[model samples]
Target: MKIHSIEAGNFKLDGGAMFGVVPKSLWQRTNPADSNNMIDMAARCLLVENGDRLTLIDTGMGNKQSEKFFGYYFMDHIYDLDSSLKKAGFSRDDITDVFLTHLHFDHCGGVIEKKKNDFYEPAFANSTFWTNKEHWKWAIEPNAREKASFLTENIKPIEESGQLNFIKQNSSFATQNEMDFDILFVDGHTEKMMIPHITIGDKTFVYMADLLPTAGHIPIPYVMGYDTRPLLTLDEKSKFLNEAATKGYYLILEHDPNNEIITVKHTEKGVRLDKSLTFNDLFN
Candidate 1:
């Protein structure tokens, strides 16, 4: 199996929101912010090429929203989905599956596109969109807290196209016959957020998703403000970090612009980052 780090795009978000109640004085040291208190974020998706199955995990926020809506997030188009896919020697049509970590706009928005008539459709015509059944229900009937992040244009089109499929939820870790990797479901970030663990030979690469958005969020208390259940996130992160450190897992950060992959170690201050690595550092 071969894994590729797909750069969807980059954007800026309020540092306060990203790091929750953590003081700017602390988080700013790792993820420095600008005058407006906004920090850099990347929509770093992952692509898995196992045999004939080419799975694209998470699509970045696409350019379908209104300019006014986009102005709020300061979207950068330097490394968009199309260009990144081409650079990796593939195209959207080549993707056989799209495994969404959640229905959040930034993670699943690129799966659909708006046409001239303002009709939204699935962008990857030949791919099957994957999401868990629990998340599918939660997103369609979103609560007030997360309604803004779950956009109708970004999600409804997949089911309407008759290409949407749900990976059955059997346990904390579930395996689908069509997928080459195992999925670990966590609920702190959102309802049934799926984190994929792809194993290649002796190494296991775990997609961090929002569970651990950046390298800076490695500390125990550094939970995001967006999470509905912050305490649950704390517990989830604690258990995952311990296992990741003990087993030596290479964590792929989804929103960190600087460090793509990171390894954590057990330090006196709990689990801390041991090394920061770029995609080529390990793969090349």
Candidate 2:
């Protein structure tokens, strides 16, 4: 199996929002803010080439939103999805499965695109988009706090296309015959965000969707403010980090602008960042 780091694009978000209650004095040391107090974030996605199946995890924020809507977030360094896929030696049609960690706009917005008369359609027409049943329901009928992040234009088309499938949430190690990876479910960030635990050769790479957005968030208290239940996130992170440290799992970070992959170690202060490496470092 081969994995490629696909750069969808970069955008600006309020550092305070991204870092939560973590004081600017600390988080700013790693992710510095601009004059407007917004920090640069990457819509980094992963592409898995395993035998006959080509699976993509997360789609990033697509370019279908109006200028006014996008202006709020300061979307920049825009890399078109088709071009990125082409650079990776694949196209939209080559993707057989799209495993979405969650349905937030920044994560799944690129699944659909705007056509000539403003009609929206699935970007990867041949792909079977995957989302767990709980998350699918939570996203579609979003609560007031998360409603803005779950846009209908980015979601409804997949269901309308009849290619959407739900992974069974019966257990943390839910297995799908078609997928080589096992699903890890955590509810701290959203309802049932599925983190893919993929084994490639001798190493296991855990896709850190939002549970651990960046290495800076490695320290126990550095949870995101966007998380619905912050205390639950604390408990979840503690357990996951302990296991990740013990097993030496390579974490595939989705939003870290500078770092791509990292491994953690159990320190006196609890689990802390160990080493930051590139994707090639692991595969080479």
Candidate 3:
């Protein structure tokens, strides 16, 4: 299997919200904010090329939303989903699976597109969109805290297109094993967020979804405020990061603007960042 880093684009989010309870003085040292107190973030996705099947993880914030809706996030970047795929020598039709980490607009909005007169439809007609069943139910029937992030235009179209598939719990599925690897699911960010764990070449890489958005978030307490269950997030993060450090797993960051992947090392101060490396650099 081959892995490609598909950069959808860049967007700005409030540094305060991204850092949660961490003070600006702390987080700013790593992810410095602009004059507007907004930090740069990347809508990075991973592509898996295995034989005739191509799997894409987390489509970026799509262009289907209205200008007013798009203005809020400041989606300003030259890279986009289609353009990136073209650069990778592939097209939307090549995608056999769309593995969503969660239904947040930034993560899954690109799954569907808005046509003339604002009609929404599936963006990838040939792909069987994969999302965990538990998360699907929670998102379609969203609570007040997350309703804004779960847009119907981005979701309903997949189900309507008859391409939606669910990953069964406690059992393996074809897509999960497509990479010749396993995926890790965790709640707290959103229900059943899928994190792909793969043995690429000789190294093990974990796609760090919103679970740890940036390398600056390695300090354990630096979870995003947007999380629905902050307390559960804290617990989940502690356990995951500790194991990641002990096992020397490389974390492939999704939202980090600068850093892409890093490995952790345990220290007296608790779990901490060790070394940063790009995935392609592994070939050398």
TM per candidate: 0.96, 0.95, 0.96
Clashes of each: 0, 0, 0
Please report, as a residue range, the 10-residue window in candidate 2 with the lowest summed lDDT. 171-180
Error of 3 at 281 (Å): 1.2
lDDT of 3: 0.87
- Residue-level lDDT of model 1, residues 48-164, one tens digit each, is 887787889999998898898878888878888899899889999999999999999999999999998999988899998999899999999999999999998888888899999
Task: Give candidates' CA RMSD values in order.
Answer: 1.8, 1.9, 1.5
Clashes of 2: 0
Report lDDT (Cα) of residue 280, candidate 3: 69
Clashing pairs in 2: none
TM-score of 2: 0.95
Candidate 1: regions farther than 4 A off:
171-180
Give one digit per residue, the lDDT tens place, for model 2 in 1-284: 78889988888888899889999999999889999999888888999887788899999998899998789888884676788899889999999989899999999999999999989999998999999888999999999999999998988898998999988975443233534587888999999988888886678899999999888889888988899988999999999999999999999999998899999999998998899999878777
**Once model 1 is optimally superposed onto the true structure by TM-score, how far is the C-alpha of residue 45 displaced, in angstroms?**
0.4
Error of 2 at 274 (Å): 0.7
